[model samples]
Target: MVYSHSQVQLYKQCELRYAYKYIDRIPVPAEASLHLALGTSVHGALEFLYKEVQRLKVPSKESILEEYHSIRNEQITKIQEENKRSQLDQQQVADFAHMGVEYINWYYSTYHPFDQSIVMSTEEKVFPKLDDDIKFRWQIDRIDTQDDTFTIVDYKTSKRYPKDTDETFKDQINLYGRAIKQNYGSKFKKLIAKIVYLHLRNEIAREVTDEEMEKTRIKYSSIIQEIIKKTQRRSNGDKEAFKPVQWYRCDSCPFKMICPLFAHNYIHDEAVNLDDMKPTTIKAVIDEMAQMAYEIKRLKEQKDSYAKILGNYAAEKGYKRLYGNENKVIIGKSENYSPLPEKKNELESKLASENMLDDVVDIDRFKLTKKFKEHELDYDQYQDLVKKSVSITAQRPSKLKEKEIDEYMDIIGEE
Candidate 1:
């Protein structure tokens, strides 16, 4: 399948989301937001601005703003008509329009006269074939030629300006540079990438090194290969081939109604009648589990508060145990030992000299368990470690309502 930078990013963001969008071909209604509209309008205006520059004509601020408004208005109308559920209101649209004007104005004033470099093309499409089967199709906002060097310029309407060390954007732009280099290597000796953050009125420009280009190629190609592997596994009926990764963006994900991580949440929210949630069904179980989890969390919070007070009182009185009429409360304390930060090396060296380092150092239980299963360790050694370190934790489940539990527990009695 053909890929774009966005598709690669989507797969990186959440593999399940990529599978839903690409593999399953699930159709989620497009969400039109003011942010997207503003970005599009701004990009369109900038494309117009640079295209004019390419033709030896620099548009005035008024002209650019006019173009921006035209595009913004058209986009707003389209969103309002097509996306009836869109949350963007008139005030937000106007504000975003004004923000777009500000960005264009700042960008124009910062680099006026438009003679810094020769504009080779605006909104240039570059298709770089990775292999016989893999190809990426993307568009650069603008391309400039100056001093035998090609500069890939990308505009950003994002509020947050990325740092110099932000490799996500760096990798994306470098990929663009690589595409340009692959397509037109004979024309230029050097390549540069310029990311213009319009909202923040900032620009980050860097030379696209050959090392970065190669790294970008390998990194993205590996991601594509991973996608291929997951796709193949999915075709073979592996249900968990594409795991959903939770992030802040999951709250706004369009696939929440169907995504395994979040589908349960919407099951109740989207249900219509009592019949939709039968008591014997998984939906009922899910709802009950949710309620139990919330109740447990609340009870834990209260338990923690009481425990804190009891702990403080026990410490103040130097008491190990407090007696009630029938039930007794026990307060226990234990400290874990670790080498001091300043003298850890000295302590480790001393332990090593005495050949007692292994005795003191904690075993990685996970690795040990793996070794045990692989029969890498002798049964006696495994059993000794297990007896020394392993302990079973048992927990019992209970359902308790807020009204059934007492508001407070008396740990100390009056003298």
Candidate 2:
């Protein structure tokens, strides 16, 4: 079995989305977002900077920006050529490209001369196998060493930097640190992690405790075991074991057009009969809809009727979430990120400095960071180089065939 943190997260997000991409291997027709395209460029530029530093050379800001723009242009062109219809428009593409320029320029300005740690390696891939049949694989963006200390620096290009307690990003870096110890026999006295938010032009550092490092290995192994069990169940004839997870983020999902939840995108023409579902279920569904209609009528609410009718149909059917032409149906509660006290204070201070505390429509962290930099020390020349960002999707995972699971188990001496 081959798995990674992202693969596990995908299973958590929606098993059905995982099934569509991995099990069915459907070709997703979604366009690449600006966040991802610019991130790709920033990562490459950082790698180039380290490689140059490793050779006892300093990379100028212009050269680094040049490399970033070059990579961004190449990536956008390749995305367009491959996805002629799905690729982003020229303005959208330019906006993303602009962000990469700012991110790289800021990154180079902050961390030149490589004083933080001795660069051990960049873009390193680690494969840690627990047994003959199971292996966990992931790539570390860059790993740096100082004396006996090992620091895994994960780069981010987001408008909002993650809190120190953000589980997803924190666990990912910790997983890398533990993997190094497990697979490479790295015995560093200090294990640290730094999330260098390129957008903010600052770094968040944490010393990884022994307890945290050890737990990462155990938790990661548990995730892998779970995936194996799920795959075994599927092979044993659990046809619908993998079902779609109904989350509101479906609008951004590449598989949304093909998801069965939407109904219209699914091309099946099979007829349904009342005889198939239990009489009780059919009656319950009708009764629920009838009750909702009555309530809507009694309340004299015209537009709210559809929500009752459609939402009940979704809830009563136990379908994950409801969505089609427009995702008007509400399946469950929703969530969004809220700034913690520290973030709020920091943002308020900056807003106060600019005398726009009340004029704040919605705080754009990217623009705010740029504004502070320009006010403190002018860099209007780099104004055109600024960029925007959102969260990026995970990369595809490695595949292992189900037919080989048994043989692989035998080779690993499993019963």
Candidate 3:
């Protein structure tokens, strides 16, 4: 049950995805987007450049940039090939490659390439758990010892930087800081955990406070417990509990077709002859429907109330007076109620006929807040339940007969 920050993030995204990727050993397709490949190439180049600087005390950024440029064409070609195979737009591939170059440039300019001394660049640093049962591991990007303090530097190519006030970033950085503390102990005078958002052209450095470390320790402990529970349930052959909770992000997920929610949606669409859906989206549609339902209910009530008031006003004015005659008292309902239903039915029928209704109607399977009673289960317990329910099912035995084996034995005949 080894877990890292990235694994934790994946689990939070979708337990079934984590199971597919890590537990079930499903192969994730190689990321072939220009942006993705360029990011990888840039990271590699930076690692190389920094390692050289660490060893030789100086490395030419211009030379590194030149080398990157030389391979840039090849990288673009590779990305284009991948895009062709994957059916990704060529424009997106080009955009991503350009962004990657920008990110590299950002990194070079921010660090002043040659000005900063590389204390430990691209080191394969690890943080092993203090407890033998908890085999938590983290490979930090770089550890730069500047002046009296040490900074754990992590490079990011994301366009947006996590705000300093963002809770998620706080948790992530704090966890990294805790890992550093747990591994290094008191070796460094001061430990600063920093995330360098290359694309955003900003850096965030947060000191490993005692409180933050404690929180990190508690968080990892809970994460480990959930992992153990998931493993236990997996070993016990509890398959039904492991159905994946379909989400909006599943659109980008490779296992969406295999996932129960997605599969169900796919089947419904095919059966009904529906239009092509976005494939991996579920939550957004559900949320939208929920909002629409709420709005519809609210609008109905509001319209009724408004109609009543208008009817009263018309009655007070006497229908003829309201209509500018001032003699006959005409009584009538303010507006028609049946029109709403007619419109709704018309839309529904059109969608059903076009087979687009299933895409709009398929609901999210995981309703955590609705299903679980408040304070009845903690966060870890809830996460464990999610993991337990999303375990990969075992394959059924084939019903077909076995093929006959042929043996080549001619020695006896020859004799």
* Candidate achieving the largest lDDT: 1
Instruction: Please report, in order, the local distance difference test score of every candidate based on alpha carbons.
Output: 0.81, 0.72, 0.64
Clashes of each: 0, 1, 7
Taking the tens digit of each residue's C-alpha lDDT, what string does model 3 give over 1-415? 4567777777766877887787788887665556667766676667767777777655666766766666666776776665565565668766776676677777776675455644664755565462566655666677777766778887778777656575666766666676666766676778888787877788877787868767766776786677667756676885533447667787688887678754433332122222665544343444445677777878999978976776788778666334436544345654643325648878778889999978676444456544542223455756745543435542332222221001011211221
The local lDDT score (0 to 100) that residue 69 gets in candidate 3 is 66
User: In model 2, which regions exceed 4 Å deviation?
Assistant: 129-133, 163-165, 183-187, 264-415
Candidate 1 local lDDT, 1-415, one digit each (tens): 6799888889989999999899888887666678889989999999989888888898998998899999988888888877776565668777887899899889889999889899999899888766678888988899999988999999999899767686789888877887898888999988989989898888888899989888888888888988998798788997687889999898688887677764543332243345665536554454577778778989999998987889899999999988779988899786898779999999999999999999889877789776754445656755644754557632343454442222111112212
Cα misplacement distance, residue 47 of candidate 1 (Å): 1.0
Better of 1 and 2 by TM-score: 1
The most accurate candidate by TM-score is 1
Measured with C-alpha atoms, the lDDT of residue 205 in candidate 2 is 90
lDDT of model 3 at residue 371? 53
Better of 1 and 3 by TM-score: 1
TM-score ranking, high to low: 1, 2, 3
For residues 285-387, what per-residue lDDT tens digits would candidate 2 score against the true structure? Answer: 5445667667766677755676677767877788767778865455764588565776998887887899987876566777777674334424455457655
Off by over 4 Å in 3: 67-84, 87-90, 163-166, 268-415
